[model samples]
Target: MALKRPLSQHAQIIFRAGVESVCGDRLIRDTVQFGPTEIWFAEHCVDRQAIDRIILVGAGKASGAMAVGMIERYQADAASAGLIQFAGHLNVPQGCERIPEHLSWPDDLTLFAARPAGVNEPTSLAIEGTDRILHWVSEATPRDLVVVLISGGGSALLVRPADGLTLADQLQVVRQLSGGGADITQLNTVRKHLSAVKGGRLAAACRHAPMISLVLSDVLGDPLDLIASGPTVADHSTPHDALEILNRFDPERSISSAVYECLNQAEQQMLAPEAMSNVTNLVIGNNAVAVDAAGIAAESLGYNHVMQSARRSEGTAEEVGRHLADMTVEMLRRDPSRHHQDALITGGEPVVRLIETSRRGKGGRNQQLVLAAYERLLELDTSEPIDFDRLVILSGGTDGEDGPTDAAGAWIDGEVHRRARHLSLNAADFLRRNDAYSFFEQAGGLLMTGPTGTNVCDIRISLVDRLN
Candidate 1:
């Protein structure tokens, strides 16, 4: 059956393009769609017979699906898949064992799941039950080909303390750094230093067998060492950098003794000649692939657009929003009499600064950017009369989620302030509280799309000259 493109399908198409591109036929061809098993085959099956036995272990939000895909792909017979599905408490090298844990199918739950175990939502413990999984991996011999599937959330999912650090200590530091707004690269650097499965240590463990990594990236620039702390990849971050991050952020703060000891061991152990010789890494998906898919979708929709540089993105969501708005305004100003419609495209992650006050409301980076741009536009109108028809800025998280809200973001337009005014909602108050959800709901700007089943940070689209 052919799918129909609706009037507002441009946004929908772009969003789906970003998500579906990762699992497209070229990528998932014969695999069981996507799962740990599929990843295993992609990495190991290339030289199947020589590889006597295959050991698959992975952690991530996409780990389960990726694993399932692997099971359906390479194994010439159902025995391999069946073996994985029925493995006991753990599976050793050449044995197939599907880990019991998994990140929530979607992202918001995955994010909230980071809350301490026993809290309201899913906890880090619910995903890859790392401690148990690793104890099994520790038993593998050099003859096994250890295949690791890594993606976002892999770090938390595969949690295993180095020597003495407790899970509690790991969680505390994770919470502090995450809430403190450290970037993924920095957070993962510290995390890599304090764990058994991170910072190339996992690769170090599989020294007996040739190891291959199949990764799905969530880091902005796709730094292998930063994604899931580069479990099976060589790490370049130094202990000095990790300690500096902690001291600079909280001088009085001290990591658990176990963490300190682990850091010391990592520095010494990582330098050994035999530690990382057998490892190979391949990063198959990222925001660029998603962005290219979006660009293709836009062209298919008959809209012209140039891919923007996500690498140059900086500052808070609003600042980026303003920059987007400025670029948009200038683009429109340059040709107020444009005879055709065009879309501006960009994809990347942006930072969101949660206000210190308790009044903070629901909103993600995507929605906040829209809110910020609207606020700026309104402020601009007060000093000078402006025309805003036929112009709208669309932004949202690729996963169909934003911040802690139901709506990803919105189709922000000039009517935002007037609509909010009519509803007696204070736009400034909403922005101040970081409450973009409420503002957009009242303004009828919400761009809701259910779980897209993929994560690549944020996607922004500016629609201009709609009917020119």
Candidate 2:
């Protein structure tokens, strides 16, 4: 049986193309190569004979695939460079590796199950895995080459609570900040201070071993210190900054006393600048790379007036969605007959603050954003009727997972609104309860794409066809 594509086939194709272009495997293959006597990674070339060992250590959603790519590349050149041995440990999301049926990992390489599938919260297993990573780094000699694969979700996968804080304490802090609508920078500020391995501490453990970090950035701007909380990079953020963020996000001080104490003591105990001298952090891929590819794909799909969103795409999902919708509507109204079709592309991770309710809701930021946009478009209909059949709005996570739901995101068109009305569903009510996932499921608006093996945040594309 042939698989069926989604109704929004062009949008789906553009998104998939963009994500695959930046996937860990492809990124590694593009930036790393082996020569006769030297190995080239990014711009750095190392003499294979001079290096005694290559140690891989890190964590993230993309780290496992990145490691696999690195291993394969190294093995391809092993015949020429037999002097260097590759080994180490990594913490990756469960079921990330698509191991071949006949082959298994090398005995020296250790891969640990860190986080469960689709759940970003850290677990006890992740802490144990992080301990092994720290231990491996501690044993590295000056002749060792540490290749760190850091990406989105590393902050959770590489879990090691500060000395005074327990796993439970860290979990509580994470829950409070996440549910409170804290952004990545604020969340990472607290995380770096509360962890023993974050904020250059992982590099510090190497004890002067040369380290190269190939980072697949999920954060905006690719701030070296914030991507995965900068385990292998120098952090200028202080304990005072973490304390301030906690006060702003956790005003009630719901975090455990141990976490508070750990942050308070972080000022004096944080890793010194000199510890990061041997570490080099490079952002091999990011949201802009994904968005640029998306735009190119959109252009190829015959979107005559494609525009990329200028805003940074932060704030509540609902607000961002409404803003995008308004932008689309304005573009169409200004020159409805000038272009046959238009596309507006955006990228960034938005936050969703759960409504206070005893009942749990199923949805993610992308779903909420699209649902809210639908409500806004309905409002616009009252003032000036829109061509219901011509507009399509889609928002999806680049990682192929959104919130706790299996769906990557949702798509909203006038047809979806009609379907919701036919089913007697209220979009505003669903938004209030944070139940966009349920609403979309009934309206046929949910977007599902199983694990794309990459993470760079979310992408939103709004399509307008005035002629239609």
Candidate 2, position 106, lDDT: 71
lDDT of 2 by residue, 225-302 (tens): 999999988889999998998899878877787887887777778677898888778889998888889989888888
Which candidate should be chosen as best, given lDDT against the real structure?
2
Global local distance difference test of model 2:
0.83
Worst 10 residues of 1 by lDDT: 86-95
The digit string of per-residue lDDT tens for model 1 on 265-378 reads 666655453587887787777778888888888788877777763753356787878878776665555554453557788887777767754777877778888878777766
Candidate 2 Cα RMSD (Å): 2.9
Cα misplacement distance, residue 56 of candidate 1 (Å): 2.7
Per-candidate RMSD vs. true structure?
6.7, 2.9
What overall lDDT goes with each candidate model? 0.62, 0.83
List the candidate 2 regions with Cα displacement exceeding 4 Å.
1-7, 77-84, 101-104, 305-313, 334-336, 357-360
Q: Global lDDT for candidate 1?
A: 0.62
